[model samples]
Target: METSRKPVLYSYFRSSCSWRVRIALALKGVAYDQAPVNLVKDGGQQLSSEFQSVNPMQQVPALKIDGITLSQSLAIIEYLEETRPDPRILPQDPKKRAQVRMISDHIASGIQPLQNLAVLQQMGEKKMEWAQRCISRGFKALEQTLQETAGRYCVGDEVSMADLCLVPQVYNAERYKVDLAPYPTIRRINKALLELEEFKTSHPSRQPDTPPELKA
Candidate 1:
């Protein structure tokens, strides 16, 4: 549990889930090394026996830290928040913390999974339509919720786990061509979050694995 070595993150360039953890690590000032996992190359390097040993689920954004390996983006983030409590990502107030969790789950569980790579791959020619529909529906609900909870960030003024979740989901929405015109609050908050150095550094376009054409 105690070591001098930096954490190792297994990530894919364009994965929203990986981007979330990347943001968390950046915000926490955790200088970790990345092990790029090409989710597309060679029929998904995540499915390879080597990466599968790192995570049986073959998911991106797995973290090796504190003498153990952890998978699932939210789980990895919570571990970081718990272990490194400086500049906290969760709110101190109980109700506000619940709201952050609600918003995070709203995107992470209710939205992103429906439009992820695996699901889209199964949809074939209909993938674009499917991703847009899912994102639009989720954003509709999220915009309403943000109207109540948002100030400068997703919850009040301070950045929380919800902000981390929101930015990447918004990026995915844009990639799928979901119109942001209907969701002013979502667009405004996403814009603010993107301006932050942590979010910028953690962006998929800026990652080590990002292709030359995709670099930003």
Candidate 2:
């Protein structure tokens, strides 16, 4: 069924939201073509009118599948899961599904939204130290929660949506020079996820959109 259709992902290299969708797609063993939207250069290609037609919000990580264009990383991920369920990114049990959703939301809602590149750029341009401080504060709370919930992965031994959320957030924290030593659970889980082929392959460095200077 999937072989007949082409799935094109419109994504940015450094956008953590795009990273999430990339990791989810890789885990599900889904094949897709990537259309890179360089976020840093030329004032962000995402803001262009051409990209805006695909996603009115002008956000990275929009998915075009079977002639349908969709925005929002989580929404796109859910759509992929519903349409292709072979390698389930979500748990089948109701309780486990809720747990995964809760973990994804904690980072998606509580952390990533505030610390996004655009938000941080605004803080820097405005010389707002308080915004940066708030990110650190949020990380501390997340670290504590991760410690309580982690066991091989964020929610359990199974690699669910939580692990997907954790890896990118950890990467962002490291980029910000945030002290990750305080979050041992996050550190451990992230390390484990990195060792896996799916997580490693979908990393920003591996993305075609990633700049040559940043690739390692």
- Give me the candidate number with maximum lDDT: 1
In model 1, state the lDDT of residue 172: 92
> On residues 1-216, what C-alpha lDDT tens digit does candidate 2 reach at each position?
545677889998778888889988898888899999887778888899998888899888898887788888888888878888868778788877887888888888887888776677777664245444555777687777767666788776788877888888888877766766776777888999999999888888888867789886
Model 2 is weakest, by summed lDDT over 10 consecutive residues, at: 126-135
Superposed by TM-score, candidate 2 places the C-alpha of residue 215 at a distance from the truth, in angstroms, of 1.5
Query: In TM-score terms, which candidate is top?
Result: 1
Clashing pairs in 2: none
Q: Tell me the TM-score of model 1.
A: 0.98
Q: What shift in Å separates residue 43 of candidate 1 from its native position after superposition?
A: 0.2
For each candidate in turn, the TM-score is: 0.98, 0.91
